[model samples]
Target: MTTPAIPSTLDVALWLFDQSRRDDVYLPAQKLQRLLWLQQGGYAAMNHGRMLMPAVFVADETGPIEPTVFHLFEDSRPPIPARPIDQVAENHLVRMWRRYSHHSPDYLTKKITQQRCYRDAWRKGAGTVIPFEAIVRDFTDLPTGDQMVRAGDGRALKKWTPSAKPAMRRIR
Candidate 1:
């Protein structure tokens, strides 16, 4: 069996960034984790296939802005095998966030939200198992806009869509 062309962790982070900007919301890091968890079968829908989970951002008491929750519809699906939370968080998502935290507090907050969202959602039946195939279908059918550019050779490229792209500052 050939390996699937699922989005990399970086790809997902970039996508989340775009989504947050488009929605005019800030998604904490934990929320990104939740998104990954749901996509990776954090919910019972993994048996079927990949899922396309939808997320929404909301503000908390801190007023710093964060992803309050993930809206998981019965129709969404994920695109990869659901790995253990530690593996996904520690290895890919969190690692990437740490690399950017020094210059980007917003990114750090979004990462935090992803984690919180996952735990909260899991407690509220997001992890209930379902027909894996159905979940996969949901993922496949979800609408994804062109958030990245591709070279003629099919190499992925980052296209700055935000009005003013966030600067990359050295982390101390």
Candidate 2:
């Protein structure tokens, strides 16, 4: 499937800034742009896996703008109970970290398994917002390994090594 065009950095910046203002969150435009850029590859239309073109326009704070696109992976077991996109967006950064990062807390309690880190924080009255940069930094620093799948008996399947990298070409 063809990848959709990514939004210009400026447009994404503006939209993020507006969303932050409306939601009373203190996110800055630069930070929003960074998040969008990091998430671009992961956004795609459901089932088909076709990437959606991202658009950002100047929008009134109270009026509806465009719906945002998100990627959905098919899972036999849904990790968390279904919820609205806004809530999903708010919680997903931490959820993704828990799934992909090695820096997550070692203890595997029911509370941590059932709720995203920020959601757990809210339940405990901490009322903290984890920064986007912290998530990004941790994700990027994760060690690379052969991607694995689960087998019928619940053990990880054999690893599949990736192909060799292509030679770099010099443009004349």
Top-TM-score structure, candidate number = 1
* Pairs in steric clash, model 2: none
Model 1 regions lying over 4 Å from their true place = 5-7, 42-47, 50-172
Question: Would you estimate the TM-scores of all the predictions?
Answer: 0.27, 0.26
Considering every candidate listed, which one attains the maximal lDDT?
Answer: 1
Task: List per-prediction Cα lDDT, in the order shown.
Answer: 0.37, 0.32
Tens-digit lDDT track of model 1 for 124-150:
453432333433333333333111222
Candidate 2: where is the Cα deviation over 4 Å? 1-11, 45-49, 54-172
lDDT of 2 by residue, 108-146 (tens): 222122223224334444324333333333323323321
Per-residue lDDT, model 2, residue 120, is 35
Error of 1 at 159 (Å): 41
